[model samples]
Target: MNGMERISSFIDSYIEDDEGLLNEILSEAIKNRVPVIRKASKEFLRTQLLIKEPENILEIGTAVGYSSLYMSNYIKPNSKITTIELDEERANLALENIKKLGKEEVIRVIKGDACKVLKTLPDASYDFLFVDAAKGQYINYYEEIIRAAAKNAVIISDNVLQDGEILESHYTVEKRNRTIHDRMREYLYKITHDKRVCTSILSIGDGMTVTIKLSD
Candidate 1:
């Protein structure tokens, strides 16, 4: 394996595997070709949640509730997760899964486009925000996320690297994907350069960026 792969494997080796229905959900997601967080990305997020212990979490994408339920495992008791999904089918499935897992009270699936839904949330409402929606809308979502985030909030954006495409020249990307590539680059630039947050881009999973908002 390559260096990063080797490191990921090593880290996963030490991390205990999830048990029971959670493990089953993850397997089912992978089997169905649903895009959930990578193992490495999950581990990274687990660590962050453990440290932050955020009471209110906002997630831009809820794909079958895999990440939401997975996060429910680590968050403090009585903590709340607000997740958005544009696809009605997926949102219904996610709500079903959340109920099945007995997390219906803890995780609420917002059925709507995140771009519009985010605007309705009260300002400074969330202590942690996770963005994993349509890559092209990341910049747009970022604007609302920042507005809704509390001071010192942690913001994690997944798939920022676009499977390593972010590092390549825009001309090198496929024509259909170039818009997403350019927008992702713009999102990365805006987050990293914004003085209110300190951001770190990591080459884990498809690639993830972690940002902590420093101001209101």
Candidate 2:
């Protein structure tokens, strides 16, 4: 393992939260080969939710509802999670899991395109946003995300680094991936340079960006 991997592994070794249903969900996801957040990412998200105590949370992806249910654990009981999933099968499965786990009361699964659904949301309503959907569409979603974010809202985006391929030359990437590569770079540049939010890109699992909105 490289230095960053070694450090991440070492830090993960100390984590032992007795996740009850969360563990079951994770196991089911693993069994089904469904993608979920990395352990380090989950912990980082948990820490942020605990500290922020956001009342309204918006999740751009709900693959089997793992991360939404996970986030529900750290937030106040009254806090609500609105997660969007574009895939019909995934959205249905996510709803099933949420209801089966008795988290339907706090979490709602929206079956639709986030690109369209985000535009319908009330402006400046959500205090916390977790984005883990399409890589190429991140730039498309950024404007609506900023519009939907409450003042000082916290936005966490996952899988921004494309498994470290982002550093490679554009011509080196396969033709099929070039579009996503270009868009992710654009998204990163905007996130880092945008005056509305202060962002820190961390070399976490698959890379992540933590950003805080300065205002509407």
Candidate 3:
């Protein structure tokens, strides 16, 4: 089997039947090509965020707010989550979902370009960050994300493996996909080598890199 197929099998084996309602919504979203964080990855982020009990959580990509709401259901009371999205349609839908779930008080959706919105956040204030936005911008986003994260904060970047696409040389990928492949590789390289963050690339759904900001 190919790398992606192998990883899919692994995730399937370990993934459990948790969060039934969330899973149902995710399934519907997937059917409509409305991207949401993978079930396994969302569960992983939920568990980690619950443990961290972050006071301020910042999410770069709020794809329909599935992951944000999932984390909200598990995290400590009164913890605030600020998620950014560029698409107006998705943002509206996410806002509706938040209100439907009665999470509007805890989960806030900021409609704008992620990089631009991130600039307005105070430095070193976020205790946790969830990045699931454009693959080509992961490295660029990381720079800003780290600046916004608190000391020893946790940052999770989804789709780092890009379905094992990063393992292939850029030239081998289709011309249209080459740029994204190259950028993902560059992002992975920078994250792995950076001394300020301790990083681990897990062979989970599409691959996720979990990083912790080092205490200065």
Candidate 4:
């Protein structure tokens, strides 16, 4: 393994394993091939929430509600999370999981396409935004997310690197994935260049971007 791999492995070795019913369920979901946040990304998010202590969070994708539940552990009391999922099965599962955790009052799962659901949310409603769905529509999501975010909001975007393919030329990407690749690049460019946010792209967990919204 290279230097970065070695460093990641060392960090993984030192990270404590979570022991709880929710974590156990998350482990099972991962074993079943459900897409959840990677270890590094999870750690980054945990730290961010601890520092920001956001009162309201908007999550664009609720795969199995794992990330939402994981975040619930870190946010301040009375904080709320609104997560969107387009898949009916996943949305129902998410609700079940939230209810099981007795966090029904803390987390709400909205079943619908995020592109449409986001339009209904009022401006400056969320102090933190997590985007992890429909890579091709990231730019679209970003636009709506900015409208809904509070000034100085923290936006965490996952899978922005497309497994490192994003660094490769567009011609090198598979035709089927070119659209997503191009769109991700565009999204990165906009966030990094926009005066409204200070963005940092990190090579963690398929790549992640952390943006802090700035006042105009």
Q: Per-model C-alpha lDDT, please? A: 0.91, 0.92, 0.84, 0.90
Looking at candidate 4, what is the lDDT of residue 150? 97
Per-residue accuracy of model 4 over 31-120 as CA lDDT, tens digit each: 878898888888889999999999999999998899999999999999999999999998898898898889999999999999999999
CA displacement after TM-score superposition, residue 208 of candidate 3 (Å) = 0.7
Model 2 ranges off by over 4 Å: none
Pairing residues by index, what is the TM-score of model 3? 0.92
C-alpha lDDT of residue 77 in model 2? 75
For model 3, how does the per-residue alpha-carbon lDDT over 1-216 read when each residue is reduced to its tens digit?
A: 986687667776877754566666677678879987776777688778868889899998887888888888777787899999999988898898788778988999999998888889898999999889999988778778888999989999998887776778777888888888888888889888889989998876778988999953
Give me the runs in candidate 3 sitting further than 4 Å from their true place. 1-7, 18-21
Worst 10 residues of 3 by lDDT: 17-26
Structure candidate 2, residue pairs in collision: none
Query: Which pairs clash inside model 3?
Result: none
Off by over 4 Å in 4: 1-6
Best to worst by lDDT, what's the order? 2, 1, 4, 3
TM-scores vs. true structure, each candidate: 0.95, 0.95, 0.92, 0.95
Instruction: Report the C-alpha displacement of residue 65, candidate 4, in angstroms.
Output: 0.4
**TM-score computed on alpha carbons, candidate 4:** 0.95
